[model samples]
Each structure stands twice: as structure tokens, then as C-alpha cells.
Target chain A: MINKTINQKAWFMVLPVLALVAFNAIIPLMTVVNYSVQETFGDNLFFWEGLKWFEEVMRSERFHDALGRQLLFTLLILLIEVPLGVGIALTMPRQGIGVTICLVLMALPLLIPWNVVGAMWNIFALPDIGLLGKMLNGVGFDYNFTQNTFWAWATVVAMDVWHWTSLVVLLCYAGLRSIPDAYYQASKIDGATSWQVFRYIQLPKMKRVLTIALLLRLMDSFMIYTEPFVLTGGGPGNSTTFLSIDLVKVALGQFDLGPAAAMSIIYFLVVLLLCWVLYTLMMRNETN
Target chain B: MSSITLKSLRHSYLQNPQSEEDYALRKIDLTWRDGGAFALLGPSGCGKTTLLNLISGLLKPSEGQILFDDSDVTSLPPDQRNIAQVFQFPVVYDTMTVYDNLAFPLRNRKLPEAELDERVQRVAKMLSMQNQLKHRASGLTAADKQKISLGRGLVRSDVNVMMFDEPLTVIDPHLKWELRSQLMRLHQQVGFTMIYVTHDQTEALTFADEVVVMYEGQIVQIGTPEELFLKPRHTFVGHFIGSPGMNILPCDWNDGGAVFAGHQISLNGNLSNPASTSKLQLGIRPEFIRLASEGIPARIQRVDDVGRYRIIKAEVGGTSLNIYANEEVEIPSDSLHLDFDPDHTHVYCDGWIHEAKGQS
Candidate 1:
């Protein structure tokens, strides 16, 4: 058995964090749980309506649409980001001053706040004064993101790719850098073509880091609120109203407390289930 | 089927080499005979691995040409050179089975399944890895993984040459000997041209038919193990090749013999290049230094009891020297006399050994 006294000291160090987590997370979670089961009115009257709100949410089309949007956005984000990021990373230099310059440029996009990213892209795609919009028009293209549903969706997806592909690039670059020079030497000696080297060596070696990037991108894309909220306002007949935006709309916009609280709980469970599945699959592959 | 030759090879990390000081590999000219087991041996940063990389076509030389069987291949990439290399660390496809790992190159070349299986099984049996064929490479020990790497390199029989860059570094000490012997056996069976690079003297000496000793980006000497030990062409080679290394003592040369710290030792033969000497020194192996009743007086410092033999370290005229003797020999407590075997001793001048006059 491990020495209990050594571990006892660790609890002392972790106590403050535990208390902070309990105050910030557990307390709010308990409140959500209480609200999930109880119905309330303006006079603070509570009526026990256990599982009724949950049943109603389970049958709601709005909940289904939001969940579907969230899943599709996450899938789209992963499909675009991973390949684009890996390509950019592979094209970057292995060493010298060029590598440092490339790393700093890639990191610049990530340092900008998410809300600012949304605002910046919103202005940049305005179709009249914005540089990208003017350029697109100059090329004799009809582009009005705010008015067109397809254009609005394209703008959001493109903006997300610009903001998040950098993250994947940085992670993969680090993974690539950590590979020993000896492996490259071995590959060279084996007469491996460029594609063979990338397929058999680089891909397998980048597995763990790719899994991490995939999980982070999936979770963030699923829960994304600020960018789409600010960029499109879920406009053009809810073309981009993701789950988080819809949840907020119900909780604060419509103020239907019981249904919104129930939806929030279900939202949390969906994210948890997806994250658990992703983690399990990644860990199983790593172990084998 | 091919012999590799380096013609006036020179390299430097700096773009322009202003002088002799700027080169990493100075104008080296050498050749490896076809189907020869050759080794480039030296201490760390002595340009042994650099020369190996140049031969393997991983590094392009700043000057000179590399020819394979008289075909100029200096500018070719490693893939175009048709050579197999095993690195210092094990580099195997971790997700593939041992059999698949060995068969990857053959499969890439579009060989038939029957031929691939035959070659893989043959190489695996040579490496004593036949039983691990079905198991994934990820679960094996480091040595076993290294064996798979070796098998991968050896399985392709059509390659012009095979190069090993310190391949046994990760192996356990006890297992190194067995692996070295197995490599020798494999070479004998296959008769492929091989160039082994290492810093370990024992591995180089025991494994290679021709050992090229390198120092400071230059080939100091290239010979068999016996020639390297018995006739080191440079002082660095003298200091590098032996166990505990050869003893080098500064001496003044006269007409008949050399004098060290006022003690005159008679010469076994006349000096070859007697008139051309500037600075001279005496070089002798510790194995040739005998502890005797009367000779050069020495102060005994320490004795190390290695299993089969004892190493006696002593100071003679303020210069430290080591003597290896049988464990049965009892050392005297206070002081001892050292005698140099004249036939085994060499006279070095200006960092090069001098042959007796009229002998060359």
C-alpha cells in the first residue's frame, strides 16, 4: 500500500482548489438540479413537477434543432481544421529564425479574444467598407453575409477556421518537433518516399496530439456561443443558432425558467456523453 | 555488389572555410571494398558519424565526390543511394507486427507475398526473432525492437550497402556481445557490403574487418584491428584504440635510442626517418610494460583488480603509466621498476610514427 501520510499532505495543498470548485461549480450545479425538478412563479411559490419538464424537453423540436446544429458545426470544424492545420504545420520550417517567425504568426490569431475575433470578422465581411468584402466584390462576386443564409453560414465557418486552425497547427508543430532526428535518418535510409514517411511515421507519431486537438476543437465548437452570436445573431431564420445560443435564448430571452432549466441539464449531459465517448476512444487506441 | 569510395571529401557547417580550422570533415579520401565489414571508429564529435552520413547520402559534402562502384553518387539523396541504415535508437513501426515491420520495405517494392514471407522469415530467424513474428512491435523490449529494426534493414537483399549508426547503443551490456556476434554471423551469411559506425573501441575492433579511425574530421588511420593496435599511424589513434589506451611519454631522441626523464632505453631497431625528426615521444602499450627487478624506477600509486587481470597504475619520473598484469602477479608495496618491450615500442615524431632508416 502507498504511504497515507505522504498523500495526506497533498490534500492540504488541494483543499483551497476543492473549496473554490465547490463554490463556483457544485453550488451552481445543485441550483440547476433543484430548478430542474421544481416549478416556480414570480412570488417564489414552488410546485413539485418532477420529470415533467424533462419529458417536455425530450419532445421539443427546438431542443432537437439546436442539438443538431451543435453536432454538425463540431463535425464541420474537425473535418476542416485537422487537415488544414497539419498541412500548414508540415510546410513550416524545422529550424532556424524562420521557424520562430512562423510560430509567432500562428500564435497571433489564438491570442485575440474570441469575442474580438467575432467582431473583427463581422466588420471584415460587411460587403461595403470591409477589405475582404470589397475584394470579393472587386472580383465580380455577389457576397452579402448578413442577408444571405448560405453566405452567413459560410462566413461563420470560415471565421471559425481562421480563429481555431492556428491552435491545431501549434499543437501538431510541437508534436512534430518532439520526434527524434534519428527517426528521420532511419526513414531516409529505408528509402521511404515522402508520402510513405508521412503516412507510416508522421501520422502514427502525431496520434496523441491529434486526439487532444480533436477533443478540444470538438468541445469548443459544440459549446461555441460568442462568435456566432455576435457574427450572425443566429439571423436569417436561425441559420446558425447553435445549442448554447438556443439555451441562452430560452433561459434569459423567453424567460421560461422550467423548460430552460431542463434544457440546460440535458445540454450538459449531451456534452458530457460526447466528451466521455471521445476520451474513451482515444485512450483505448493509445493503450493498444 | 558495390564498393563505396570517397574522393577528396570535405565538409564544413560554415559556408566558407577560410582555413584548415573551419572544416568539420577535412579532405578525406578512402574506399570500402565490396562486401567488406567496415567500421568507422572514434570518440564523440570526431566526425565518425558525419562520414557515415556522407556515405549514406544523408549529408552532402562541401567538396569531393562519393562513388559507388565507380558511379558518382555524391549529390544523390539517401533514398536514391539504395542503402539500409539502422540508427542508434530502435526505429520500428510500433503499430505493426514484427513480421509486417520486416516486410514493409519488400511490400513497398511490390514483391510477391511468398517472396516477402520467405525473406522476412529468413531475416527474423537470423536475428532470433522468429517466435515474436506474430506479436506487435509496441509490446517488445527495446532490444527486441532494435532487432526488428536490424531485420528490416537486412531483409532487403537488393540494397547496395547497409549502414549501422551505433545500432547497439540502447542494448543492455550483457546483450551487446551476443548481438555483435549475431551481426557478424549475419554478415557472413549474407555477404552484403556494410559500414558500421561507433565510438566504442571493443565493438569496432571485434566487429569490423577494416577499422577506420577518425579524429577531428580526418581519417587518421584505416586498417585491421591488429594493425590499429600494433601500428597506430597517429598519436590520437595510439591514445584511442586500446583498453585504458596506450601510454605516451615524452622523450628526447639521440643516435642509438630515446631517453625519458634521464633514463635511456635501448632501441630494438634503428630509426627509419632519423634526420627528419623535430619533437619525439615514445609510445607503448600497458600490456608491453613489464614490472621487473631492475629497469626504469617507478612509484606505485594504485592497483585495480579487474576479474581476470589487475591493472597497476604507477608514476615514473612524474608521468603516469598503467600496466596490465595477470591477477596472480603480486605487486610490491613501495616502488617498482618498469621495462619496455623494445619490439612492441614505437617512436613517434611530429604526431606520426617514424620508421627505421632504409625500411620504408
Candidate 2:
């Protein structure tokens, strides 16, 4: 018989982390809960408003519209980024100086601060004087992004794609490179076509990393705020207002603290639930 | 069925290989006849895999040409060479089922449905994987996965040759015999040219009709298993083949007399000696060393009883030698006269066998 001694000393190693979480996550979360079920105007005056903010936020058309736009944006980019990232990664060189150059170029947009990225695009796409705006106007198209709803949405989506597709490319490239040379050799001996090799070998090997890329892109896109907020200020007729932007507007602009807290909680729960579903679906067939 | 011929084939990974050491595979001009079972037996860095890859067209030779039955396939790729190569590790599509894995090659070529099914079922049944046909390939054990790899190679009956690079390296010891016998039976049934590479002597001896022993990127000897044991052309073969290996003793040749430990030993025939100052050694298997009434004196060092026989480790003039004796024989304690069978003992000059006069 084997004997395992009971050791209570290991709990000391995790106490700091527990204290940190209590200070950081749990306390702030409790504050949000307190504000969600109560109302306060000033001077510590509070009134009990049980679930009123939650009910109002759920019924509001503005919240639904923001969620719909967020979903559309996420869906459109995912549909574009995944395959496009994979295609670009496949075409990327496996080795040499060109790899460093390509990676640096792709990472340039990601390295820029969110505000700077928004400002850069704003000035680049301004109707009167910006380079892209002047070029589009010179090309004889009405391409004023601040006034046109279609152009505003297009510019925001395009900016996000430009900013984040490199992440997908790098992840998928790592996944593609992880496959052993033996598989390619055996496939060659088996007379496998190039497409067959991609389908049966490369794609299955990349599935894990691609899943990670999808989850990251989905969560980040769902909660996007800084770039589009700076670019169009969720304007051009609220066309680019996503969930986080709407939450910020309600919290800071209107000072609707109770409704904002309720909306924030719901937004967090939606991201958690959607991410859980995506993870569960992706990992279902992994077990033996 | 095809007869593969390698004409002055050499390979080097370097861009400008100037010397013999730069070449991964030395000048290898050899022929593997149709439907022959051959094994490239060597150690880890002996260039056997390089030769196998060259034959399969996975690697093109840096110089010379490779011909498959008079067709120069020097620059052809592995796909067009019509050969199947089983890698050291099993390579199967992880997402596909066992049946689909077997059917992959046939489907790639757009074979008819009934024919593809028949081939897949036939190969699966050959590998005893019929029950696992629907299971995912990734869920199988290492041995079964390797069997699926072999099945994939064999399912395509049109492949002119099949190459195995250490196929049984991952198999359990007890199951290796089973799989080897299965492979032998399959070879007899299929009758396609097969080239197997391994560092294990037992695997090479058991699976191949002709074992091509390689050392340092060169072919040392190519012969049947019996010939490899009886008359190893190089000292490397003699040392690498037998269990507990052959005993190689440094000796001297003075006026055509083979002298060991200040005593003269007579062999079966005369040696075509190299330079008198050059090095020479007496190579003999432990089985041929016998207890004699009067021979070279040696002291008994240790004796190990390994079930059927006893391995007597002894020292003679600062050199250690192993002798495999029957369990019934009495072991000498202090000193013993060790005799070498004249018919089996031979002289090696600078590692190569010095062929006796008028003997092939």
C-alpha cells in the first residue's frame, strides 16, 4: 500500500492570489451588483430599485441595435479573417529574411496604440484633406466616411481587419509549421494531391490554434470600444456603436449608472456564455 | 514488380561537397532485383535511410542516375516513381477513419467505388484491422497505426517497390516477431520488391532474404543471413551481427605466419597479406572458440550462465575475449588452452578480410 502525507502548507502559496482576486474581481463585481439593484443621484442618497434597470435595458431598442451591429461585425470579420488568414499564412515563406520582414509589417498596425490607430485612420479617411479621402474623391466616388453610414461601417470594419488579421496569420502559421515533415513525405509517396494534403494534413493540424484565434477574435470584437469610439465616436448615426461603446455611453455620457451596471453585467455574461458554447463545440470531438 | 538499379549514386546535403566525408551517401552502385526482400543493416548514422530515400525518389541524388527497370528516374519525384515508403513513425490522417485512411491513395487517383472498397477491405483484413475500420486513426495504438501505414503502402498494388525505414522500431519486442512474420507472409503473397532498413541485426537477419550491411556510408557486405554469419567480409559485419558479438584479437603476421600472443596459429588457407607494417587482426565468432588440450594460454576471468549456455569471459595477453560454451562443459579456474577453429578463424587486414589464396 502507498501512503501519501497530507500537506496543508501548499495553501500558503495560493493565499496571495486569493487576496488579489478578492481585492480586484470580487470587490468590483460586488460594487456592480450593488449599483445594478439601486439608484443614486448624489450625496450618498440611494433608493431601492430592484431589477428596474435590468428590465429597462432589456426592453430598450438601442441596446438590441448595438448587439445586432456587434454580432454582424463579428460574423463578417470571422468569415473573412479565418480563411483569409489561413490563405496568407499558407503563401507565407517558411524561412528566410522575408519572414521577419512580413511579420514586422503585419505587426505594425497591432503595435500602434488604439487611439493612434483611430486617429491615423480618421485623418487618412477625412473627406476634405486626408490622403485616402482625396484619392477616393479623385477616383470619382462619394467616400466621405464621417457623413456616410455605409462608408463609416466599412472604414471601421476595414480598420479592425487591418489591425487584427496578423494575429490570426501568426497563429495559423505556427500551427501550419508544427506539422512534421514525415506527413508530407508519406502523403507524397501515397500520391496525394496538394489540395488533399491541405485538407487532410494541414487543416486538421491547424484546428487547435485556429480555435484559439476564433475565440480571441470573437471576444475582442464583441467588447470593442477604443478604436471605433475614437474614429467615429459611435456616430455616423450610431451605425458603428457596439456593446462596449453603448455601455460606455450610458455610463459616462448620460451618467445612467444603474442601467450601465446592468448592461455591463449582461454583456459580460453574454461573452462568457458565447465563449463557453464555442469552446464546447470546438472541443467536443477531441476525446477518444 | 521492378528491378531497381542505382548507378554511382551519391548524395550530399552541402551545396559544394568537395570530399568523400561531405557526401551523406558514398558512391553506391548497386542493384536490387525484382521481388527481392532486402534489408539495409547498419548503425544510426550509417546512411541507410539516405539510400532508401534515394531509391524511393524522396531525395534526388547529387550525382549519377537511378533507373527502375531501364527507365532513368533520376529527377522524378516520389509520386511519379511509383513507389510506396513507410516512414519510421506511422503517418496517417488523424481526422480520418481507419477505412478512409486505407482508401486515401485510391481515392486520390479517382478509383472506382467498388474497387476502392475492395482494396481498402483487403488491406484492412490483411492487417487484421477490419473491426477498427470505423474508428478514428488517431485513437489507435502506435502498433496499429504503423500497420495502417503499411496497409496504405500495400493497398496500392500498382506501386513498383515498397520501402520500410525502421518500420518495427516502435513495436514491442514480443509483437515485433508477430508483425515481422506477418510482413514475410504478405511479401510472399504480394511478391513486390521490398527494401527494409534497420539498426537491429535480428530484424535484418529475420526479415531479409539478403542483408546489405552498411558502415560509414558504404556497403560492407551483401549476402544471405547464413553467409553473413559464416563469412563476414568486413570486421564491422563480424562485430555487428552476432549476439555478444565476435571476438577480434590484435595479431601479427611475420613471414606469412599468423602470430597471436607469441604463439603461431594455423588457419585454413594462406592470407593475401597487406603491408607487413600494416595492422592485422584475427576475427572469430565465440561459437568457434573451443577448449583445447594445448593452445594459446589464457586465464579465466568470469563466467555467465545464460540459461542454455555459459559465456566465459577470459583474458589472454592483455586482451579480453568471450567464449560461449555449453552448459555441460567444465569451466577452467586458473588457466585454459583456447583453440580457434581453423575453418572459421580468418585474418583481417585493416578491417577488410584478406582473402586466402585460391579461395573465393
The number of the candidate with the highest lDDT is 2
Q: Output the number of the TM-score-best candidate.
A: 1
The Cα error of candidate 1 at residue B134, in Å, is 3.3
CAPRI-style grade of the A/B interface in model 1: medium
lDDT of 2 by residue, A51-83 (tens): 999999999999999989999999988888888
Backbone clash pairs for candidate 2 read: none
Local error of candidate 1 at B199, Å? 0.7
lDDT of 1 by residue, B122-149 (tens): 8888888889999988889888988888
lDDT of 1 by residue, A49-130 (tens): 9999999999999888878878888888899999999999889999899999999999999999989999999999989998
Clashing pairs in 1: B271-B356, B271-B357, B272-B355, B272-B356, B272-B357
Summarize candidate 2's per-residue lDDT along B29-128 as a digit string, tens digits. 8999999999999999999999998888888889999999999999999888888888888899999999999999888878999999998999888898
Tell the DockQ for candidate 2. 0.78
| DockQ-derived CAPRI band for the predicted complex in model 2 | medium
